[model samples]
Target: MSLKSERRGIHVDQSELLCKKGCGYYGNSAWQGYCSKCWREEYQKARQKQIQEDWELAERLQREEEAAAYGSTAQAPPGAQPLTFSKFEEKKTNEKSRKVTTVKKFFGASRPGAKKVLGGKRRGDAPEAKSGSPSISRQVSLETDRVSKDFVEFLKPFQKPGQDLYKQCKIFLEHMHHKRELSIEEQSEYAQDFYQSVAEKLQTRWKVSPEKVEKAMDQVEKYVMTRLYKYVFCPETTEDEKKDLAVQRRIRALHWVTPQMLCVPVNEEIPEVSDVVVKAITDIIEMDSKRVPREKLCCVTSCSKHIFTAIRTSKEEPASADDFLPTLIYIVLKGNPPRLQSNLQYITRFCNPSRLMSGEDGYYFTNLCCAVAFIEKLDAQSLNLSQEEFDRYMSGQSGPSSSTSSSSLLPRGRESSCPEGSALALVRHNLEAVGQLSRRQERVEREARRLERDLIEWTEGLGREVRGLVQRCPLRLHPGTPASGTPAAPAVAIDSDNLEDPRLPPPLQPQVYAG
Candidate 1:
């Protein structure tokens, strides 16, 4: 069979590509068969464990080396040294051995009655691993179940009041899940109302403290949202996904906007500033990887802080809102974070209303929203550039060339017959001149600084040499009498004008003349 025919014959199942942890999200091979959120958690766990193991290994190696060196230095026979024992040392030794044994059991290495099964199947008579020791996934699942059960048990003291609230929340979630006709706005309003009602009940009926009421509300939100995330997030009923794509495309087109153009203080050439900018971009891009509203909001906050920090480092002063907003816009333009619109909408619709109303988080999120809006509606007027120039950039024809300028290419007082056809040729000519001028200015600045430094160094060296020459070969002059006992001649001052050429050096004064 032909290669094309063989390729067409292959079939792949979508279910096989689902997350191995059974989160219902599509999986990626690079993420080790998990979705982005799950992979992030797994990676953090693995990294932490790796660091701990590395530390332990280093300590072990150091101890072994110290022991070897000590043994070598102690050349006396074994019986020459007196044996000593202390209760503390014995206790420590026993504890160390116990820890080692526990670690082995935890890893299934020393588990009692554990058996290996053949062909990936358990034999009828084979013993099972202990329930206390489970795989990572199993442990996570068990921990989640434990937390849920504990929460239920905690609410049990509240009696029928908590049970009724819980049942109402479940019913509301079920109704929202099945009702495809409900808009996001309606659902959000309903959710907010339900949350407020729960909060009031917790405070009034249950007589819970104000402090505890917020915590109870948070738990309720988490419980409700965890179940509704798949249905509500980036649903097809809304235009969030389409807006995300549009914003992404717009950001990509504006990639030529440098930090200078945005009036942002960041300079990517500086190592510190570059690192901060990169981190800001990374955090912004990670916003969509999160599944929860609060987590997404946190990502925005983190990204904004990084941008602000970069601005502060670049300017060497605390950045104001003006500086922060521009820098954030520049970061978004550079990052082109995925699902920008969807993530924003998700946070707006699902995050707590109080959080979005007032607070530091709200302020930063509002700025981000403004930055995205500005980017989406960007034009020639917004950038302080001509329409022709903006269009040329958007069309990817803003490179330097040796052709005629844009103005000259067009007829006087009239538009060109074929604007698009002539745009590349005309725009390139103007851009070429601007590019050359900018490069020349940069080169001049660099040369000027170099010349200034060299001049300062040369002048210092000349001063030092002159001082040394004067000290080595001193000229003695008597103010009242001449050495020859003749009448002292008046000191002569050299006139600069007496030089033949204006650029020539003036005559030197007589050194031995009487004062």
Candidate 2:
């Protein structure tokens, strides 16, 4: 119905203006013919509720689909009722019926009235098996089996001296599969330990010579190392995931020791080198220098130094080779050191510095630091020059322009006017004596202070005990009171012969003054 508004004198349709929910309120244009506030809110609530219901329905349908797809419906209690998937169950039943029907069809076709074929071949024209010729597929399978057997036999020598070869191979392969989880050194140590244990067992059980056992151990280690290197780094093998997994899981190498693993970094900050580590390595190289080439050792040492320096900037463990790869690549690419640049390809291909420096325990870095400290101590022992003078000498900073000779840094005194060599010796001796005296004085002072503190504590403890005893005594011996049941107090006595007693001091003596 059209109504006239008195305020504006405008005609409006009452039915069109009214709220659709019958709220008895005029609808606003903003609400699209519904009450603006309440109807909009109710509409939003309805939409949200519908959306929630749809989402829940979708999730339930997905779960049911997954359950049906996997074909296992026993989800709840020990003996819950099976859920029904009518279409799926029907399909399965139809498949069974179809298979049965096909079998029956085959039997029916074999009836007496049906056309008979010779030897199960249609029309007696099918290809006949030739007795003398093997199929290509059969030949390939036979060849593969033969190769595998031959390979196993080839690896027999690499097994521990007296253990079952097959069993040892299995264990080694399993170890290789998990070896990447540990650092290269740890893996080497483990392999070495295994070799040692096996060798010892064989030595005791088989009465094998120590030298023979060592030789066997070396062969096994070498085989393992070569095999591991090939398996891990080979281009054709490494990319094939299935082959790689199989190799890691089942392939065993005897034990390989590359030059990189054995290389030790040089001391840069100290004049004296580590005698023990350097000497051991030198001895090995001298004994069998061909096995560990000097060039390879040098390259390994250089690469190790670079990696150690690179990682020192960050305390976080490097997650991959990429972390330091860029820096090393830059160094090689820059070509400032022409030799290193020329040999960069060979170094990268053969020597993996990342593997060497990746020890979780930081043994390589620790060893390098120890070597440097040892060298520094040795230089201090032998060199007469001060640290600054030594530094200048090493850096060529004390050339013709510099007035300070190595001996000029010697202690200045009447001894300074002596001959250079003699003065240096004298100064060194004096410094050494002074250092020793200072150390000895510090120790003596410390001992004296400790002794004093102990004496004080002991005296205080004794004083407390004496005071306690005197306070607890009941023999007061007062002149005014008669001594009843209590025994008479002893008279104070002094022993002149024992004047050295610790308790003889007048201040420490207990008073027996009558009140």
Candidate 3:
């Protein structure tokens, strides 16, 4: 059975997934739901419109500045007529008429005798006069322009070699552009060969060192690829886009797969772990936004770092490939990044071979590809679930059992049916509850300690007060002993004499009553 047939009942809105332009191509969120071609067209049109508006604005501002300056320096010429609104309007109209006439003459120069009438020289044939103000083209800005300028400055001393290199690259690009028969692979091979030849020339012909040659090659790649991105990336001749759509559909269908199912140790309940996981997801999704292979590779590395951080946060140990790969797969499933296949293919086909063959970027990119592959071929055995269970989940008849606890975490009336949502809700709710309980426990312990301290302080104070009172008025063990440190006098022999003086009548009365 086909893979599509196995993933039955996984429904996605066709309109939502397809290009908004109705071009029968898959859409990407990075392009605002348009295919790459449509996106590029829209972007160019918008940019052109913006440039026109900016030019008009700048012209208006310059005119206003000039007018203000003239007004500030107000002093009519000695013989000049007094200016009036009517005269100003008439003068403006006359100037506009003169401009119209000039334009007509310039355009009509193609006609016979028109050039002779305009001094026998076409405007195109004459050298353009340098102006104090910058040209419209110069006013237009691009990020790559700065890089190009820096490169030019770097090549200033080697003008001949630079021009040769530029001419070669331009010719090569033009040839590739016109040669419609060349396949994408053949074009890529040609590009690679050209790059290698250029590097050799920089070293052998120009005597550039190997280290500088690498930098120069980087600049060259950037210059070439920037111009060729639209042509080379997801070209109509390739099935990379179709593979992208397939992977997207598959990932959407498998949205129910959870960390538990994948054995990915991502505990979103921990704040640190959750943040790292989110960063990783963001990095993966942002890969589509970058146009360069190096930039996309950097995104992969960033995502890998985040994944490792998440694993460390959850497991409290160093993460290995065994831990890293499953987590990456889980991240991919969660992120469902747009144009996954096309981006990977672009990087593989065009990225500097040396950069991809070695280094941390290469390793992370390979793991990412493996993760994507694992996801594409995922089945019951891959997830360690029974075939019947997998089918039920795929058909939307069942969800992962691990998500059941997540239901209780949802709000009373606002439960999510999506397994991923349920799982995240569970983590968020459990984390909040744990945090609350932890705070309460801490408060209780704090209050207990405070009460214990107060009791100890009160007991100590009471003991001190009692000791002070004892010291101030010492208790006499015997009536003969004094509080002062003095020797006790001899005890009196007739204690009855002292007692009988006050109690003699009482004793006689008690004896008569007892008898």
Candidate 4:
């Protein structure tokens, strides 16, 4: 190719500078396409074959990248290193999936921790079975509460006619005339239960049915309402007393007497109390001037004063030990201040002022508060204060402080308690120091009820499952299509202990306060 230039020994054209032997022929250049005098014809053929194969592969790869980048039927591995793929693609996909799942969860999907209810198949996820599920047990406890309370108020009067006043109802019923062999005091017993009283009164000339007595009670109720409108309701009180009286009226809406049938005259004059209750209350109240140090003392000041007045009536002597709990409760629940103050002042002026004052610190107020509070705990705990009953009691007073009192407080024990004053000598146990033991009976009862219900359900469920299994597998052989090699036996499960714990109840989940 460089023949003319080489022969003439002259300047060659720049295009003619192909290489030779590691040098340009004139001012030499190395070969680009081939080394000088390169050897085999077969190598050249092989190099050509490799080039064609590599070019085809490169094209195929390019096509694959394009297919991955654009829409294509071929699915890439999730971790495939496609040329066009990026790190964010996988992350973005995952995030979108999570958000969609979350949205589904809130809008009635069965997801954990969702505020709304969700449908699900798992037995544990069934609405009532779920832990911390919404419940109306507390509400049920309230409506049925009347049964328990009425039991307390009325049962004793009938069972123990120690009071001549209540026993007189029998006398009045036997004889049509008001004048009976029994004393006027006997008339009092009829008033003990409004239901009983209605029964006794309606049958003055005839035998009364419980239904008829109920009807009479309905009429008496309206009549009492009219009387309240005319008499007690019309009378003026201090603004606060008016409010309390309204509440007491509500508490006694249908009836006004305690089981004792002692007429708590509406706005009855409060007897002066320089007694133990008053002293205790005064001390408790004075403990903290600013905060009302409510925890330290057993009773509130108002409750304490009322309690002392209730326990020590001017018309009556000091309340017996039997009278203490009820007297305290009545004072706390329904007592008037002015009447109590008037009574207290009367006692101080007429009776010995020194006697009125229990101690120098008391002036009788502090003692009153302590005594009343001591008695309230007593009522919370009785041989009768079953778990269901105490829970019902605690629920009625469900505030923060009330919660603490329910949990941390101890019941008074039998040692400090006086023996029951009934004709029967039932031993009155002292309240536990911490109050928990006192309410144990109630807790146990509630547990028993729950267990009874659960046992019935579990027994029925187990019976059905067992019966089905036994019927289905008559021979206890392979129940399904048998394996060729291994003849599988019908599996029979025998798990007996499926009982749920009565203790450690699921947390009482609160209902959201939606306006």
For all candidates in order, the CA lDDT equals 0.65, 0.40, 0.68, 0.35
The runs of at least 3 residues in candidate 4 whose Cα sits more than 4 Å from the true structure, single-residue gaps closed, are 1-290, 295-302, 314-316, 333-515
Better by lDDT, candidate 4 or 1: 1
Question: On a 0 to 100 scale, what is the lDDT of residue 268 in model 4?
Answer: 29
Residue 226, model 2: lDDT of 37
- Model 4 residue 39 lDDT score: 13
Q: Per-residue lDDT tens digits of candidate 4, residues 1-515?
A: 23121111112233333223223221111112121222112234555666676566556655655665655424656766544345334544554455333222221214234122244232222344242424543443343454334434543433432233234433533342332222211222222233344456556634556565444344333322221111121122112234334433433331221312221211223324435445534533433221111111213444444544555664366544234334443443333222232222122112211122223222223333322223223332231334665465445542223222221122324222435442112212123333767588789999999999999999999999999976754432325545686766544332212124343344343355779
Could you give the candidate ranking by lDDT, starting with the highest?
3, 1, 2, 4
Residue-level lDDT tens digits of model 3 in 212-265: 777777767776676566567886656677789999999999988876566676
Positional deviation of 190 in candidate 3, in angstroms? 1.0
Off by over 4 Å in 2: 1-170, 228-373, 376-381, 399-515
Per-residue lDDT of model 1, residues 34-99, tens digit only: 544465566556656766765675567557555655675586576664323353345446655554
lDDT of 2 by residue, 100-159 (tens): 232212211222223344464332122324312458436634654564465465546645
Best by lDDT: 3
What would the C-alpha RMSD of candidate 3 be, to one decimal place? 25.4
TM-score for each of the candidates? 0.49, 0.23, 0.54, 0.16
Clashes of each: 0, 8, 0, 48
**Best prediction by TM-score:** 3
Task: Kindly report which residue pairs in candidate 3 clash with one another.
Answer: none
TM match of model 4 to true structure: 0.16
